[model samples]
Target chain A: MTEARDHVVPRRLIEKPAGGARLRNLGQYLFLAPALVFMLLTMVYPVLSNLRMSVYDVNVATFLSNSAPFVGLDNYVKVVSDPAFQNAFRLSVYFTIGSLVFQFTIGFALALLFNRSFPGNGLLRALMLLGWMLPTVVSASIFRWMFDGGNGIINFLFESLGLLDAPRHWLIEPNTALIGTIVANIWVGIPFNMILLLPGLQSIPDSLYEAASIDGATPWQSFRRVTLPLMRPVALSVLLLGFIYTFKVFDIVYVMTRGGPVNATTVLPIYVYQLAFNFFRFGDGAAAAVLLLLPLSIVAVGYLWLSQHEESSS
Target chain B: MNASRSNRRPGWGWTVLSTIIVIGYLFPVYWMAATSLKTNAAVYASPPQIVPWPPIFKAYVDAVINNPLALRSILNSAIVGTGTMLLTLVLASPAAYALARLNLRGATLFMLLLLITQLLPAIIIATPLFVLFSRIELVNSYPALILADTTFTLPFAVIVLRPFFLTVPTELEAAAKIDGCNQFSAFWRVILPLVQPGLITVAVFAFLMGWGEFLFAITLTTNETIQPATAALNKFIGQYGTQWNNLMALSTTVALPIIIVFASLQRYIVGGLTAGSVKQ
Candidate 1:
């Protein structure tokens, strides 16, 4: 990837003939034109428009007319001051960190498990992707059924094992609702993390582990020394990617609990959605949405840098 | 397969443990399928029917026949999915080819733009898009939904397809050019055909996204008549709160197309996923 990126410019300069080079450049731009135009209109324009909307007093009337009184960070202030913002912010952190810690650990465990060859290894790995491949709505809804209070299978299992005194409604109780969504998100995420980590694990040379074992290292010690250290870059990439995906989650939480049992699962994306669509507070919503971008941008930059570093280092 | 490191055949113990783990992990998917096949009595049975002993198609029948809403939403989803797939392919292929084969100025900038576009939350894009579409009277329309779906798909398609194009040696295009083919024909005729798998992978994923997309479908379209399957399924859950059998049936139906595609093309799709994200 780095080789392709680094040498593209000079190769192009040499490849193009002097005559009609400008016209060829223009023609090449034509190939990119449609996608560029569509992206500009849809993605780039929306982001800029969202930024403009964030600072303006974009009420329903002003939003429709495309003319808003410039409130100049009032929207941001209003959103930040709201108690819901704080709760949502806290929940977002809890949800993201909680989801990441479990998803990575469990996923890494699965990756390690599958990293060892066994009969049906490839098939099992592929099958594990079922959860990840299903639409988030479907996953959330299935979880919703399983977490039901009265007849939910989760409750049934809990009661059968005597884990709970009673069958608690997981998604209904405020205390457990966020956990419920987090569990569902974890399930949705595990397969992805496992898949990402598998390649990292595979990239490790087997001779290192063999040498470690020959040096009287136990299997556990060899894993801790050889595998974990070697897997660091890929693990970081997986966690960063997982954080980005988990942080902006909306559909799963919305579908599972509608971000409630009294604001339990109301993460930042849900908060933004509620502000923008349900309450028609577009400006405030845009402000909150823009705020969500800050951490993501930092992480995205980190991710890009890390990926490039991995490429060059490898 | 690195497990046979010492030249020892993998023990069946590993297979047994792995099988048990896979089964436990996939139990939810099994439950979804099982619940979909169960009769209402079986659905409500205490301790729940792990397997539909006497499986019935009543829920499937009910979801499809008794509920016009389910069928209509599916049809709407199909339209959106197909439209998004076509639009993404039409736009993405050329763009990917350009990025791969041509050294246009600001190529790095464009690549950066594509990456940043993907990182923006759907909510962020949805907020502005809703307002903009409303101004242009495009809300509550298929085009609106399809276009919104494309925001994610287009970037993904280009990213995935560009790798495929890169692997196709520039010599192929050069050879075609030497044979009197122009740049457009060389790309249209030679390069496009070579990346068929990538195109299919991108198309399948784009379609899946369109079919399963919830946020834009819900936020951009208020009319029940125009909403896609994911949004309609959410509404179904709300309207028919504990009708687990029907909900699972609807969910299963909505999920079947994607599952089928994934199963058949697991290799390419998996490869495409790693290529799109990790780029290593």
Candidate 2:
């Protein structure tokens, strides 16, 4: 009897003309067609072209020419072996990891602070976002001036606070240029982390905390057992997104140091920019870009997985 | 009752701490504005002037009059920003609506594609885009920057708007369909009005992306006349001797619109970020 009912339901559902259903499906696809076409032309084509151009021996002369020769794996070998690429790869790793650690820790503290109801909490949190909202160039320029060796406010403040014996060249010095850029990046990223995590903090029901309190749990215990596990998904998303964002940062380093002081701050993006634009070596630049994509793609994939899992679990 | 009272009255300490933190965070922005009004000597003083005593408007005047490119760059930024916002909305809204509402095949795949697109860094595509745009004779045009900026904003717009569309109940569209309205009109009359805030959020974000865009703006537009403010300000880095005061003036002008937008749309911006990331 159940099988017969299922058959009847199918028959009734299929009573509409197949042509009409097909036409409706086509119309639905038409809704997606414009965006898909645009992405294809702009995003997909450029990525594929980058890959193609990486294998060719293209420079200023051959870049505009149709006769650029194909050199299989040559550009990749050259970029990978170049000392500048090695230094940049090392610096990029340090910069991204350093920025992420400081940004996350400070942002988490701020998030915890702002999680509670206070008189001026809302206003303070809004003001905190100014760092994140300001244009990258503006922030970079501000930091450049603030970190200037001669007349920088930072040195002035440090001297006033008795933390320094003399003014230091933050951007021009080889040892401190990368660190200066990293400090600026950390400031820029903290608000992003806090804003994302604040919602996660809010989502935890008060009942959980109440229950914890009734059980005579300490505040630290409650945070460890209740908040940490609940906030894990949000935390993961923030870290992964932050990793990708910070890893590909160009403008901050560009404006502040220009990946300079003898390539102290030459992260991968700046490295690729210098190769492609400044030096006019399109093939090597494209090769380095592909290299840059490898690590970011891993993080991106992880983020996509975590976000999908969060959606499904919720 | 006593504990709750104490908690509620834990006032001055928290207020002072929070105020200090806020001031620390906003100090750089304050310095940017203050430095712009300082005289050259005061700006470079041994103890950097905390506030420009008897604040001067010389740098502002110099930024406006001496720097012709500053005004031109701002105009170009507006043009590019507006263009990108409009293009992104037109393309993303329909797609986002379909993905949210229609139970279509391959919807998951489309979403996955969009997610992956966000991972592709702008520099990876800069080389090829330069080649292609120059080939098509669009190297220095507004459309070139607008189109490139859309590449960054389109996925973001879709991601932000999809959740909003999901919130709009299907029953409203179904009821409209039951009446005389066709599918298009049902969407137009029933759904569009409800998602106005989402549209505005996406528009503001897209505009900001275009305005603040640096990599593509620098890569594509070699002409100062067509360059945006971000790229133009980059030129003043080592130029005009030290010119720190003038640079700060230009930076302040560039940062003003962003500050205004954030102030007015704080709610939507925060909502969009949270909804796009955490909720998803």
Candidate 3:
């Protein structure tokens, strides 16, 4: 019976040859065809077009027409040298770093707090996710109202608590405008960080903590030694993803301040939008976009390399 | 006995601390609903009322009756969102299956391409898309927004769904093939059913992507009638910034569906997001 079964298995496997392999290969490619087509049309083509348009001076008049004056890196020169672009670059760096630091710290705290089993923990954690789940525009609008000079609850609360001397225009003043947007962004970002980090925290074995405690180590000491080292990869991913997401933030900045109060909050994405749509300078807009893409591409490549290396090592 | 008592005391303290933090975090959302129920004068009152003494729904009434455009925009959002979800699922499912199941050459390259696409900011693509849509006269149209949203959703759906496909055992497909099913038939009849949960998760994500889409909505649509709720509400900011009550009411309206969807599908959404990252 065993010999008969082996013969049957070998015959079945040997039945298909090169033709069947080729046919299966064709079928696999066919399955991939639709998604590949859509990606090329929507992503690949548009990105290449942006690069092409950056070289040419395409404005409102020539935008519709096929022919535009070719300016060959002049737009790049113009964008890089532009004062607004430089300020926006500075602000982008500030905003990304600020949001990442606050979001990660607070999010990691929340993750640690919720790591243990407790009554109502699951429900509370789910409720906290509401901030991340809300529409960006809705959140922006709510924050806009909350930060309103006279009517905002923020001022009212601050004044009542003696935290502020007066009702400040949070979204309008140049100095406070960027800070206000960053505050709202941090609120939106914390839940994301927590959700990602919670799993990492949970995956750390309790035995390690008990082992540390048995050695007379305190809670903080265990966290420093056992938790932080184990959580490194997760935290790195969270920070990297947070940097990428926050660096390209447009909706909150656009809706909250519109990069206003003298362009204090004009990050890179907002700058690109203003140049392209508001000013009708498509070439410069595309050039600014290409500039933005360069750093992000580097980060993305790094992320890919790290993840691949991680998989191979594991 | 003393050690156990000490543990219980800290647990209560932690719970109280967590409640306070959550309340503080959700204050803005709570304030949104409260503001919608307040009179315009009361909203600007120096000492804001913790609870509206005499809560009113007048703002909601006004938003519903006076602002017909808001309703229309919501309808437009639904249409676009549904279209994006359907199209994204159709395209992403087969691709995910191929990537997860097939021994296709250059599959790694394709996965890398999808990851790179995520890093491409919307503003980068928005410029050329606007130009292209204008050339094709698709501006101010639902299809334009849907297609743009698909660009964001498709890559995400493929990435998330691919892992779920990988979890399905290969023997299941081989068994289906033994029963005289071809590759496509086996995928459709055997594998698709197994990954239904993943499909639903991706669909929910795709729909939310379309619903909450703001950048493309504001950029691609010139006509107010064609704009989604996000863009429509944004117009109110410029035109009626003083109407805080009405504006908050409209904001609540826009946020309600997302809240409902998230509350119901929190498990799937969280699972899908973490599964994509943690597995890799």
Candidate 4:
């Protein structure tokens, strides 16, 4: 990928340019050069610089103390030891797992549901996407209000129906708070998953299904044997994409809980912000931020490796 | 006939299931709008008012006129989002064209690089970028906000634009070149115009990212004047916790534009994103 991007693909890009196409050359470069520079400056530079910053001492106190030491890898060690950090780390895993499973299951189910022709299908698809397109703050805000201990929709409905004897602490209770945010995240993420899987469903030939049914394969058996394997690439991409987006989710969690109720819902991004801006410990925050990046970088690298493997075998 | 009848059963099951699924999915958004128009008293009234009667626009009014932050944040968001779309299009379209059409030897590599850049979650770079921006005195600047935030949306533009650009054959460009146009002019005149849908998708992605940016906006900009609507919305959940009525009203307002745009352009977005996603 880097080779193709960096210095070895211009000849290929021509796509059979006729002999001496001057306008073609200029127009193509005209389109490509500026974007390359832009990515280098904004996207690539900060990432490289941050990787460097991860190694240095960057706290305000350290700036105050000329003697403040640069301890390589120590901040990573410290972040690993802190329980709050540990909890945040654990939460990221749970959040990623819970969201991926729910989003995929529900999203795939919806995709299959929408796959067949039905009445009001168009309206349903549009309405289903409402949660996905509505900004996180907007959706989370509604749910946050709904989850309010006193007047929240959950409590109000349950209490009035006489389901619960008392108002439940939906957002404050340790167990419920994480679940609340996850539910909100799932609601927001499903549309994306469904949309991705829909295309995969479309790509499958209906003839395959007809043949399967003719052979006495139930719909369940056909799905397991045929659709599941065929949609693997689409399914994997959605899972990874969901993880990439959800792992760094800020607006929803922050808007809903601010990682509160004894820090029950704090994820890594919140930790990064709190440390840098709130605690005024830039160095510590830098360290925490690096810690967050480490796990994500590993995941990114692993996915990239798998993709390369797939490309090579194909 | 039995086989046909049995096949038909699953279709009916799917219809029933989809209706139930959609209702289950839309419940929260439904609740949000429903609760927003209710009076504070009615909002909290026991047994809940799922169907708010004598609905009030009081929350909308509060969010728009009463809450000082809402207006400010929306303005700030507009400026940042517009800036991102301009920057990405002005810069990325050409590069995407080049990657798709030029003689650059590493074109596939460029495409791959863009894809790889997207693999990591933004949290990985948010803090370090935060500090770096602050050091350059660009933390509070709109330009920095737009440029830094484009990382979230621009790669998809590059990837999405590629296939579209790739579909435009070299024959048109060759003809344009023969007619004395420069390569850049040919792209603008011949190839670019053909890829307008890709450009629209790119613009939408850029706008959404800039519109929805929260972490960086909240972290980078301290002043209310510069904060986006999302940053300001976060302010509603302060030390005392949520101010639900005002928050709901603002949420309704935040969602209204997307709902409007989505109502018109959902097919494009779904088609565009699906194409981009399934390409791999």
Candidate 5:
């Protein structure tokens, strides 16, 4: 409301010094100052430092030395050229796309199912939250066990039900491990997507559905016309949020496969960790991570845009 | 025949559909519990033990006491989680109040900036962060981790709590101001009493964000003493194979507090969660 009167971007609010309440603003800023300083120190500084690192080919072993060759465009060239880097890039795309596809499909289906009335719906909703609420590492650990070769319950069930001809190498095989991790992640992520879409469902008025019924529309047609169109914003938000969350998913892949069966599921976050911790190439790791951060930062930019739009409208 | 069957069924399709959905969600938790009980040998049994051939209490016991870090990690997680919750409210409440009630300079801009920070995935700068902490010579320190984890969580609390702060009518603050009170006095004595749900929401947001944190805890502190139970789960696997039963047992133990908090405070959470997602 005030922004229209002021007409400014990054618009400062009207600072009323004459009011008795102005003194409290001092205390408020004082309180918020530490968090602001902390963000600047830890988050802001490191981001700028990585941006600098991305432009230079600073070697790992001799990073502390001033004499380490600074080859401009070399790191980017090497990153784009190196087969391992390429493979990691390919695998990250594969993982992101595969996970997002399944996550969207299953999440939408689950949302549609749970959105309806049923016996024990409340208890079932609470139960569904279990897969989402437990820490990611725990989820990964359970998945790791389920994929175990010998006594693994997955293989036991599959073979017993004649789903597989033999005990499958669920994690050990390059073919199955990526799919397995995606499956595990799909299970974990469905609840979140459903949670978002559920409220979206609730917000859609029953009158609309009743109107569609009076028009002799089938349940499917009513849903197609009335529900899905209205749900676009929430669905869009869920999609964006899902991308942000899944793109940074490190725990499941780290724990279950550790960027393996021979680096099949080596998504960007896992690749970043491996380059730093396992390979001790901090600069290289930082560089790879910077490349990944660009897309994520774009999403953050979108979030900022939405927030501003919300403020002006509100 | 189709019309008769459909009429006779009477929403059984929806019933069966919901049952399948419920099963899909329940099966994983069941799997986790089932595996936690089975003997290592029986975990991979051919027929899969309906009940573990000989269920093990040993993993749970071992997880609680064996390396001793297990217990300490839990304590560390609790302290850090609580500390983050306190710090988030202490800092965020005032800012949220100022944004909601006090016409501070560029309150919306400040909020927009903070919201940007919340979406930032912490993984991007993990390497520099480790080195930065090392230069301060505080890499394995609790303060090192808490301060970092708070960065991840504080923006969320501030954004969620801000909307609640605004809902407190300007009239209340004005009344306090008119009654021989300074701005801070009015905020403290009168305004705060009204925003309890927002505060609870912030506290819960802070605690859970800190509780589930992993990247910085793993990267910044490699020590046994200061790490969280989150990173300790990584210790279960080594070069040879995983210690699965113990891992699940430890997970169950560590997750107890978070589950309890969610169960108790879920109502407050759902109210603010929408605002946080948009504003944050």
Candidate 6:
């Protein structure tokens, strides 16, 4: 099932060497300066600026003038009070959780299936990555068309299969619009999950599985007892990374519904985009963005700690 | 383990089942391509013409030849993609090399920063960047979009390339230094050529990121003249909500380059991905 050489490039490249004191050259700081400066201007400054904008009263008129007065917590208060904010907050939860559950399960299933020896395993796996490789806009557009109410293929299939008496417009109804976006996201995400999980699956020793079988364990029993426990670390990383990716989804929802049919699909990112760009409520948007970033920041910190832990322990 | 695994051949049943699964999963891709080829009427038909019986170029014609914005958006994407790729390499390679070899005191901390930056939501950065760009009158310009795109790509490029740099034995650089090459020249003359494959991989990844970028392009550049294919496709979907054929055609056009690149560079790209994620 696996390639003769699973890695096409340097095996030595990825293996982290133990921390050792090496030649220290301050001139190397010159090498680092350009990227450091660029990141400071781009990443560090923008994040801090976002924080600043959230606290200040930044409207369109004041945004450029650099004269917005400090209004600590007011923007956050208003953003929280807005009915739309609450709605988007709830939807964001549903969207993120909904996407994570389905994509992870389907992806894991595919990974396990592909782990066993079979013909064309490599080709099929590569083909599966098509969904992940394509740009989000492309995937979202295809879904938008396929989910069209009147003449969409999904409606045609549902009616033929006797699942529906008539075509249900997937994206039009507020109730189902979030589901539509989640479905598309699952397609986009499944490939990624499968790819990551496969390497982890490969890393588990077959001798452990053989021992389980020798002990009269059934395949299901072996999976639960041995595979599941072994897969925990990889699964943790996959889910955390997937959570962050799905939580900040912008292109799929934006292209599919644009938080449409009465704000039905407005996730946090969409909400932030609308508040700032559409409504010209920069301060409130910044506040809302900070709210969105809050959980992600926690998750990011957890992921960092987890990776560092994995590194040191291993 | 290899011999035993290879000897225990799975039945043809497994092959058939997996093939079915692949086809089912890839149905959306097929549908997109098929719809793009169908006539406008065929697109709206109830059964949705599982096969575009007699393919037509009408949608492609309409999408590209008729709608001038399609070509313009594609051109904008190229410029941005190229610009971002070049900038990312120039900035990221040296930094990545430094981290890999220089053993700077703060290298570990800087790497942590890069990883977190890669994970930061684009909207978070876009909000401040939009305000900042408008203030500086950099909004609605190619430089603005390219610069914004780098916020995502620079960290990514650096992360991906550092491993490649580490693979290059430091003795190579030491030998170059012995030959009277300064540190910079030694790195430039000796180490970089060895990591050309990694450089190519990062360039492709960065270009694709730039080409497909949406939020920054849309938020920063309200000018129709400067919008990339992604924003243009979105605009098309909104304006021509009923034009499924044309929409699919445009979507296919936007996605074609990505497909080509992926096809050609599958090995290196896949290797780079696993190295970044799994090895971490």
Give the fraction of reference interface contacts each candidate recovers: 0.62, 0.58, 0.62, 0.52, 0.37, 0.62
lDDT of 3 at B188: 82
The residue-by-residue lDDT of candidate 3 on A219-310, one tens digit each, is: 78888888899999889888888888899999998999999989989999999999999999999999999999887877877776777787
Model 3: which residue pairs collide?
Answer: none
Model 4 reaches an interface RMSD of: 6.5
- What is the DockQ score of candidate 4, to 2 decimals? 0.48
Better of 1 and 3 by DockQ: 1
Candidate 6 chain B — worst ten consecutive residues by lDDT sum?
Answer: B1-10
Clashing pairs in 6: none
Q: A222-249 in candidate 6: lDDT tens per residue?
A: 8998889999989999999998889999
- Docking level for model 1: medium
Candidate 2, residues A117-210, lDDT tens digits: the string is: 6688788888898898888999999999999889999998899899999999989999999999999999999999998889888888877887
The Cα local distance difference test for each model comes to 0.88, 0.87, 0.88, 0.75, 0.73, 0.87
lDDT of 4 by residue, A201-238 (tens): 87888778878888889878989888899888768867
Clashes of 3: 0
Chain A of candidate 6 compared with the true chain A, TM-score: 0.91
Model 5, A48-72: lDDT tens digits are 7666666655455554443445666
* Interface RMSD (Cα, Å) for model 5: 7.4
lDDT by residue (tens digit), candidate 5, B84-125: 888777777777777776556767677766765655667766
TM-score of each candidate structure, all chains considered together: 0.95, 0.94, 0.95, 0.90, 0.88, 0.94
Question: Model 1 compared with the native: what TM-score?
Answer: 0.95
A97 Cα displacement, candidate 3 (Å):
0.9
For candidate 5, what is the DockQ-based docking class? acceptable
The alpha-carbon RMSD over the true interface for every model, in angstroms, is 6.1, 7.0, 5.6, 6.5, 7.4, 8.7
- Tens digits of per-residue lDDT for model 1 on A227-269? 9999998899889989899899999999999999888889999
Task: Evaluate model 6: give its TM-score.
Answer: 0.94
